[model samples]
Each structure stands twice: as structure tokens, then as C-alpha cells.
Target: MPAAVVDAALIVAAVLDAMLMAEADRPYAVVSTTVAALALAVRRRLPYLVFALTLPATAVSSAVVAGAVALYTVAANTRNRRTLAVCAVIYSVSCAATVGNHDLPAPTRVDLLVSVGYNIATAAAAMFLGQLVQARRDLQQRLAEIHQVREHEQQLVAQTVLAQERAQLAREMHDVVSHQVSLITIQAGALQVNTNDPDARTTAQTIRDLSVRTLDELRHMVTVLRASGTAPTELTPQPTLAGLSQMIANSGIETRLDGDLPTDVSAAAQRAIYRTVQEALTNIRKHAPGATATIRVRHDGDTIEVVITNTPATRPTVPLPGAQHGLIGLRERAELLGGTLTAGPTSGDGYRVQLRFPATTQ
Candidate 1:
């Protein structure tokens, strides 16, 4: 049930019970009783205060339910046992004092004993019910924590397996792939020297150059994969504003860099800008092929913003495999740097990604 519904029900029931028990003579009793009963609306937030308001009503016949419910709420929410005991005792005394408000003569010994015993028992019952509710709430919180811990453990296990596999793959690439690529480079260099034909010599030289670049890229990957033992590690020498021009040229899409942004921003801010552009360009390639992209980096006051917008794809998009967490990681990183990232489809049937962050940080 919704909490609002439960609260409404409690207030209604308490008011109706108060009306039934109220004497017809005292209009003030009716008003006071109703006010105390209505106070139940905020019992969850101010349990002790609400109970105190209900205490005066407890010594009259009109507000029986209000006092009991208020006492119960205090017991359910309060963690201090001594405080709860004190509240319970006060409630019992007020309830027993209700007899003094009755029309009958001063009560005999047996009646007084019964009144005290019965009121004490009622307060005890409310305490027990409240304690039961408190225990259930604590149990539910513990169960939620257990579920979260279980999920974290599973992620750790999956990461360990992935790290082991990458380590093994790195070894193979270093020993087998690197060795073959080196041999190809050597053979291409030899052919370039020994060939007499101009075309063959030129082709060998091209092959040698490509092989050497491949070896360098391969070594970079191997080093990264081998070092990633416990977490998903990004490649070293991460891209920044200094490489923005070169990256745009190499992205394979028709693109324009539209701003001359500052280069003195902290390295973290630069990487955020670089990654935002890189990811935007990558998505354009995958999901919006043949699209034209415009990257605009702006510095206004102490804030830097990068806006990458792409026109609609000129060709049909081919489905590609991706982890799909690039934007999530970027969003998380931006928040860590006191920044924000937003991406969505444009009004012109295009896509746009915007990244904003503070320009300077210690």
C-alpha cells in the first residue's frame, strides 16, 4: 500500500474513534481530540513531538486512538531504549488518568488497580508491535546490502577472468605476432634494397614503413593489456587537446574543427574534451556513416564546452559490436570533474553531444 493511503486511513480511523468516545458536553474536547488525531499525518517525521501533542488528549475519553497510535509510532522509530521506555510510561500514566475525567465518584482500590494495569498493558502492546516493525525494517535493509555485495563480488570475478584472458593474449601477441611482424619488416627492407625495378622497390619501401608502424601499435596494445590486472585500464598517452586536430583528420568522416580553445586547461579537462570528441566521432562512424560532423569548443568565463554535431547518415548504418558503456563512463568522469555531458538526437534528424566543465583546477 502507498504510504499516503496508510496515513489517510490512520487519521480517519483515529478521528472516528475519537468522536465515538467524546462526551457531548465539552466542545473543547472535540476540538482538542480532532487536532491531536490529525497530528498523526506527520507522525513518521516527528514521532516524539506528535506523541507529546497527543498526551494531553490521552487523559480525556475523546482521543484514545490518537494516543495509542502516537505511542506506537515513537516506539517503531526510536532507537534509544530508555527514551522509548520513558514515552511508554508517560502514555500509561495519561491513559490511567482518563478515569479521573469520568463522572463516577473517586474509584475504589480494585478499579484503580485495573485502570493502571490495563493502561500499562496497552502501552506494552504498542511497544511490542512497534519493535516488531523496527526489526522488519532493519532486516530488509540488511537483505538489500547483501544483494549489493553479491553483485559487486560477481563483477570482481568477471574482471579477474577478463584480466587473465587479456594477459594470456598479450603474451601471444608479444611472442608470436610481434616476432612475425618484425620478420616482415626485415624482409621488406631487404627487398627494397635488392630490387632493381623502381615499382617493386617503392612497394617494398611502403610495406616496410607500414610494418614498422604496425609493430609500434602492437607493442602499445600488448603493454596495456598485460598491465591491466584488476581493472579495465585505458591505453597510456591518452588523447588531449594537443591531438584534437590530428584526431579529426584521421576520423575518416568529413569533419570541421570550429574553435581555437585554450591549451593551458588541466590535463584532466583536456582528456575529457578529447574523449568526448573521440566517442562522438566513433558513434558517427558506426551509426551515422558518411555523416558530416562539426566540433565546436568554446571557452566562456571559467567554463569550457565542447559541442559535436553530426548531420544525418548518408548511407545505411551497419550493426556493429560495442560494449555500449563509453558514454556512461564519460558521463561519470565528467561528474567527477565537476562537469556535465549530454547527448541526444538533434531537431534536424542529426545527433549532438555536448560536454562542459570548469577550466581550471588544482
Candidate 2:
């Protein structure tokens, strides 16, 4: 219906009810009806408070029409189930009491019966309407909660994807750079002792040639990673137990390899050991570039252990941002493999990193 039509209908109802029913002529009845109508204006804003304020006046005046409307408003608008239920019971009881108290003659019987029927119909209809309102509100709330949970799950998936991408990039860089740097380290050590011989010039040229090739490979790898639809290269082969001795020798660190290595250690356990060695060497290069270092790998039956210790360099090393992140990452990896990693300054005036892993195939 149009707004004008609705307003006109309501005005007509109020006027006709006031005029036709002599009971509305009473001051209490007129006042109660006006108050109830005004109370309904705020039903959506303060439903329970409005109902409480209007109900007693309605009951005292026996304004069944106004009281029933207020009860319906309370039932439909408030989320408080207990309050609505209590209002419903009160309205029902007051209606029954008001009807019983009326002493009517034969002429009034029809009016009384009509009033009772209207009350019963309005009560039933209002309760059903209130239930519909409550159901709609509950459904909206549930949908909002579900949407939030799905959004949170999506954010978590995005973060995981980003982290995996970073790790893959790091692996690619390591493969290319480690090989070239290894050549530099080998040639530099060779030059420290070999002062004579024309063959030294040939060896230096060989190192430079290998480094150029490695740089070309690195450029190709980076280009492949950036271009759309290019399939990523196979993951870099993770270092294993066999690479430990080579790593120590290449690092120019004095390392003692003793005791038997568990041949049946889990892949996770082996990876942890490799990462521990890699991080220790990187830290040494950055902090104690020319310091003497020692690394030990041993298996004591049920456990595999690796320990790396380096002497302090003569000059103080500047700390770098996220230097601790390496140790933290190494520790987390160790714990995941049912092992432990500890890295910090040692009492012997240098840094030390230790990793211990369970030597079990499972």
C-alpha cells in the first residue's frame, strides 16, 4: 500500500474506534490508547523498555486492543527470548481477566464474542509474525559468521603460498651462487700458497671462466622464474649426510667427523643437519671471516648430533638485520624433526651452533 493510503487508514481506524466505543470516552482508555500508539514508534529502537512503560497503563484501563499490539511489538522486535515469553503470558492472562470481569446483557453478547475472537486471532497471528522476524535475524547472523571464517581461511592460504614462493626463490639463488663462490674460495686458497709457476695464471683463468658460466645460468634461471606460464625448474637437490665432509672441506674449517652416522635416519632429520651446517658456515663468513672453525658430526646410537664452533676474528663484526632469523628457522626445523638446535656465542670467544636429531627411520 502507498504511504498516504496507510496513514489515512490508520487515522480512520483511530477515529472510528474512539467514536463508536463509549468505553474509549473514558480518560484512562483514551490516554492509554494514545500512549500505546506513541510507544510503538520506538519499538525497533528500545522495544523492551517501550513495552514495559505501556503495558501497565494498558492493563489498568483494560485496553485490550492497545495491550495486544504492545505484546506483539515486544515479541517481534526484541532478541531477549525470556522477556518476550513473559510479556506474552502477561498479555494472555490480562486478556482473560478483562473478558471474565465484563458483565454483559444479551445485547452485548455479540460484541463480547467478536472482541474475544479478534483477540485470539491477533494473538496467534502476532506470535507467528514474531517467529518469522526472529528466524530472519538468526539466519543473517549465521551467514555473517560463516563469511568471516571463510575470509580468515583465505588469508591463511595466501600467506602460505607467499612463504613457499620465497623459499623456492632462495633455493634457486643458492644453487647458482654457491657453486660460483665455491670456485672463488678454492682459487683464493690456492693463490695463498702458490707464489711461483706459470700454471697459476692458467688456474685463475679457469676460475674466471667457470664463474662467467655460472653467472649466465643464474640470469636464465631468474628470467624463467619471472615470465608468465614458464614452468619452474626442478627443486634444488637438498644436501644430505654425504655432503657434510665436502661442506667442511670447502669452508676451510677444521672439522672432525667421528662415530657412525645412522644409515636409516629420516629425511627430515638429515635435512635439519644439512641446514644447521649451512647456517653455521654463512654466519662464520659474515662474522668471523678469517677465524679458525671446527665442526663435528657424530652418531651416538639413538641420536645424531652436529656441532660447529668458530674462533673470534681480530676485528668486531657488525650485526645484520634478521641474522637471528636463521637460527630461529633452523631451530623450528629441528623441532619439527623431533630434534633441537641451539645457536649463540660460546664461552670460547666465538659463536657455536649445535643440532641433535632422533636417529630413527620413522
Candidate 3:
């Protein structure tokens, strides 16, 4: 829109210059101004060629409007400082030539001075306005680049936060759901041994096998959550209270068991109990290799309590490094089942873990 307006103004100026030259009886003034104005229309697209054409018309006529427009276009479009300088010098020379050849009966010193001053002022103003426009365009481009960089950085931060949240959810799901699946596996094994009918035994064995496979898949999911590539060569189902005796027998450390375990407790409560015991025994094995441990389970009507304690290590080996979220996972499990778990050093030179759950509730 601005370019069209500029072109229209240049044509109007050319017509005015032609009328003035006709009154002064200058030769071929209309033809020279018409050619200069036509060249102005293509100044932005072919700045150097338009500028060169304007010099010849400027030398033949006294009007400088078309030449001034061509100079501004050259300065605004050209990025090279040396090229702009050369165009400015050439345009200044054309303006001087137009002033020297002005039609007058007998030009005086004051007339010449006035013509020279007007030509210099007009050329300087056109160059200054063109440079101002170029500076504004450069500033706008830099601001756009800065905005894009900030937008990209914000996207990266959002993606990182999303990944961390997913990993945390994966850990919570593994801790809570894996316990219930272990209970199902244990019950199926027991049913297979106790049933006498051939069909009943076969169903029980199938259930047990499926449960084991589910546990393997769960372990693989947990490994993915932790961002580790290594998988267990022989996946094993998690242990429960039914297998507590066998676990103790396998451990080389001396251990004792006490309290009456309830078979009628809710599955949620049973899971919380099993996790607390498992985490406690693991801590003992990792931190105190030769420690003597004791396990206790008690039913007091509405609530069930389980406690596992281990003496200070008699031959403490180098403590194995672990994920260190065992106790944290156990506490989360207990709380989800409306229970509480506590673990710390006891007053008797040992570590103790205790869990209490409402026996009748999920």
C-alpha cells in the first residue's frame, strides 16, 4: 500500500514539473520528467538500474523529485555499506548538475547558493529516512528470534516434567498392585497341593502358572520405569506370609518367629503386612549380613500388627547399594490400606520395622 502511494506521488510530481518546464520554454522537459517518473516505479525492484537512469534525466531537467525517490530506494534496499556510499555520491552529483543547468535569464550568486543548499538538504533527508526504516526492520527481526528461542526452551521443560511424573506413577503402581498378585499366586499353589480331584488340581496349577507370568511382566514394567535395560534372567514371584517359613530357612542368619497369623484378614491388610516384612528382611540382609532376626504377627480383635527386628551385625559386610525406596514404598502401601508403618533403630541395639492395619477393612 505504501509503495503504491509513493509511486502515485512520484507521477503527480512529474506532471507538475512538466507544466512548470513548459511555462519556462525548456526543450523536451516533459519527455525527460516522464522517463524519470516511469523509472521510479521500478526503483524498489531494480534499485541500481533505476538510479542510473535517473542521472541522465536529472542532467537534462532542473526538477529532482524523481532522483530523490530513487536515492532513498537504493539506500533502503542495499545491505552493503560501500554500495550505498557509491549510490549516495552519484545521486549527489546528479542533484548538483540539475541545479547548475536551471533555466534563468541571468542567474546571480544568491540564486546559485539557494539552489545548491536546497538540493543538499533534500538528498540528506531522503538518505536519513531510508536508514531509519532499515534500522527498525533489523530490530523487529531480532525480537522474533528471541521469542522463538524462549518458546522452544519452555517446551523442553514441560516434556521433562511429564516424564518424571510418569516414572513416579509407575513406581506407585508396582508397589501397590504387585502385592495382591503375589497373594493370588500363593493361594493357587496351596490349592493345588490340598485338592484331591484331578480336575481341581489341574485348574489350580494353571492359575499358579499364569500368576507367575504376570509377575514377570510386572518386573519388566518396573525396569522400564527405572530406565534400565537389564532384565532378570529368571523372574521369580514375590514371597508372601505362606512362604515365610521357607524364606527364613534359606537365610543363613539365625531367625525366630512368633505370634498367631490370622487367615481371615482382608487382602489389603495382608498385602501391607507382607510388604512390611519383606522390606524389613531385605534391609537386614543388605546392611547386616550376620544379624539375628525375629518375625512376629499378632491379631488383637479389630487390628493386626506385624513386627520384624534384627540385631546389630556381628560380621557386617559391605552394604549393598539399592534403589533406597524400599521403606518409602512400604509406607505408601500401609497408608493406602488405612494402616501405618514405622522403621528405625530400636532401643536394644537393633533395627525394628512395625506395621499395624485395621483387620476387617480393605
Against the true structure, whose lDDT is highest?
A: 1
lDDT against the true structure, per candidate, is 0.79, 0.61, 0.70
lDDT of 2 at 165: 60
Give the per-residue lDDT digits (tens) of candidate 2, residues 97-158: 45543455543677777756665666666666877877888999999999999999999877
TM-score of each candidate? 0.57, 0.53, 0.57
Model 3 C-alpha lDDT per residue in residues 199-223, reported as the tens digit of each score = 9899988987887677667766766
The residue-by-residue lDDT of candidate 1 on 151-181, one tens digit each, is: 9999988889899667656644543455456
Clashing pairs in 2: none
Worst 10 residues of 3 by lDDT: 228-237
lDDT of 3 at 163: 61
Deviating ranges (above 4 Å) for candidate 2 = 1-73, 80-118, 160-237, 245-256, 280-295, 308-328, 342-353
TM-score of 3: 0.57
Deviation (Å) of 32 in candidate 3: 2.7
- Poorest stretch of ten by lDDT in candidate 2: 225-234
Clashes of each: 0, 0, 0
Quality of model 2 by C-alpha lDDT: 0.61
